[model samples]
Target: MGASSSIPTDPNQRVQVIAAGYGRTGTVSTALALERLLKGPVLHGGSQLLVRDDKYCKLWLDAYKAKDAGDKKKTLKLVKEATAGFVATADVPPVDFIPELMELYPEAKVVLVRRDPEKWWKSVVALTSKATPWWLDVAMAPIPGWRYIPAFMRRFSKSFLGLAGVSDDKASPAELIERGGPFLLVAHNRRVRSVVPKRQLLEMELREGWKPLCQFLGVRVPKDPFPRANDAKAVDEHAARIFTRVLQVWVGIFSTTAVVVYTGWWLWRNKQQSLIRAWKSLKTMDVRKAFGNVWKSIRLIDLRKSFGRVWNFFKPANIKKSLGAVPKAVWPESKKPVVEHSTGYSSIWLE
Candidate 1:
């Protein structure tokens, strides 16, 4: 039995339902149904780590490390910490630690949610068909803030593939599933049955719906229909929606950044041109001549002030007469006779 030394044993807050099911075996629906029936928080696989608090991701990582190191006590402690506040835990990390969980909370009911293995495998393939590519993993490795996505992908790949004793990095999904599916499903079901007593174990299919689950958990049947969730189509739609929204956001960010950067560069270039023009104009300016003109204006002002009376005495009756102005031109009597050019066109061209 695994030791739970680090976890404070709480009889009152112990997990009441542990859904020991493989992924894509209607585990999501089981989780939702259990939550509604049990009327308490239920931790579903990847829900806590991916959708909920990212802090739980690190906890799972630690638990995975502990499991790999064969430290059952540490693994149990990490599982307890990860699922501390939940009343029920199902799927993934929890499913992997079922034996330890049964030892910790013997009173907790274990529900083995099963489906047709082939159909389950199909659903799994549909859901994970878009698994992050190896190139994407490497590309995202060096990115600062985007490490979580690749980290989650890596951890998820490890947990799911590792459970089936397949290396995701080495094998394609089809190959992994074909080779390991039967053994994985059989082993997991056998292990759960062997560990939990018949009285405390409930084997169920989603098609069986709420009656069995309700009876097992001792909860009144809900008036509403049993939740048939995480269908392959629904999963695909949800993934597409999320992808579209993320793409739109990234496009918007890239566009806004491009506009801002281009505007700043254009403004800087214009300012640079203006500065260059000003410098060139300044360089061409005759500084000595400009200073001379200024000095000459100042001297004229001084002269006007020193000889105000003499200047007025020498002034002519009319300034125009003193400057010898010419009279305006007068027209001759006959329009000065039109002149003809050698080129067969009048000197005075007409429209």
Candidate 2:
């Protein structure tokens, strides 16, 4: 079994919901729903979505230029309180907040929303992470070659989820689903059941079709299906279209720049050797593994290879290594080498 619940058991206090499921599992939508359903203040992810709103963008931009290095905390607090109009969204680096947030919001509803893992992965790569936010876009612009892609992915994926209007992006609880239909939802429900008595913990859709949800909360159901939350796929398609346009232009420019850079470097070396060797280290197992990944991306698969992932309160270090992501155990305090561009290149370019 997973270690003890990190959530408080209070049935009456402010519910703490983590919405820990992967992105695009409908976290923003749930935040929107909570803002209305909770009928009170909500403080959601702040630093992460500065680009999503003019107020936040301006605040951070000013802070970045300000001489007062200590103004960040005050500014963050102001930003949090400023958005008190609706369900507040405040997503930030997950690991950084886990310890303090859990302590700050005791009795908070810990809603770990989940969805089909494959869908989650694909949605991340396709729809959400494409923003190439200032964090990733500006920062990664200088990185060279293969070393750049990983940081580029994380900064975009974890940073501001670039979207137009804020709806589900503001307040919907985590979504739970299985490939078969609500698998993660069922599993999450089961996990919660293992700890809290079923009565206190309700598992109803945050929509009108689900009668019990409002009943459980002592609110009357609306005449409509919980306001037809507009988290529809069309929103994704629209934003994706804009991103696709910018991408084409940027890709062309970058490709040209790269060709020029490598060609000149090759001539300067006076030898025909490559800087990095060929990509021949690819393993047969990796090729075989990619077939499943391809199938999963197309929604053609729903099989589970293991349940061992559930046994730890925290996902184990060994599993992370197996997954090939930068493991949390060693992720922080690591730095990539910086390449110093020579003055010769500038002089050559000017000439």
Candidate 3:
């Protein structure tokens, strides 16, 4: 079944369904079913971030970080930010935050999609084996415009592998899943059961078909068969589509930025060359002569000022001395005279 046209655009709109199911547990099918039943968008894995207008990959990454930090409030906020405008969320990253999401949207019905544990693990191994390799993801990371590919891989590893306690140590998917798969399945199911009330939760397997799901959601089952998604070929095709879309977006942005930067630099260089040419032309025209004339005018003005000062000093009342002679007004007057002799020398004193 196709998604409904009635999906609301409001990011803050209350969510109607929360698929608190691990990946490989018929999540894609459940998401499709929920979208058809709810008549709104159902987010599933990276597909929503890739296909939809909402770019919640970064927000999901942030939510993972918040989860690691054990900050429930921060995790809730980030989950809400990522899942906003969507009526339902199914699959890995969303499933990892089920507890916080349950608390945040208490009114939302929880669908715990289930499958035989061994079969689920087998599916997980198969899918992860086909995933982009760790080395390839790392190698492509430093390349400009390809960083998103590695980023998506890392987010997947953290949300899926890390949560399952599978080491991202370059091990084969079979080995990693063998080590972590059983425990992850048991612990995850146990946690979900412990948290969600029986009335609010519907445990389902895709093989059980649409009736159980439709009844749980109080909606009519579609005439179409239940969605059986994430087959190997379908998974590969979806991955290709996501990669193509992401690559196109990054390439377009990179091309646009390059054009803008080159245009700006070309315009600036042309303006700079024009200024240099204008300066060289002024040099050829002997603009220094004009500067020299101005300097001469300034010096003449300074010399005129010096002459005026000299004339002022020489005016009658302003003159204080003539040659080396002292002025009589400045000399001391004698009231008595005395003579002294010392070492056959005589001196006269006036007081």
Best by TM-score: 1
Q: What C-alpha lDDT values do all the predictions have?
A: 0.68, 0.40, 0.69
lDDT of 1 by residue, 132-154 (tens): 54554544333333335556555
lDDT of 3 by residue, 1-351 (tens): 112223348776677888887777766677778877887777776455444332445677678777777898898888887777888887766777777888888888988877788887777777776666656554444344344545555555544555565546344444455555655676688788998889999987778999998899888889988877755556777667546755676687789999999999999999999999999988788678888998999887778789999998898766754332432222335443333323233443434
lDDT tens string, model 2, 270-318? 5443332223345324887788788788675333323344544246675
- In terms of lDDT, which candidate is stronger, 1 or 3? 3
Determine which window of 10 residues in candidate 1 has minimal summed lDDT.
Answer: 1-10
The TM-score measured for candidate 1 stands at 0.65
Clashing pairs in 1: none
Model 3 clash pairs are none
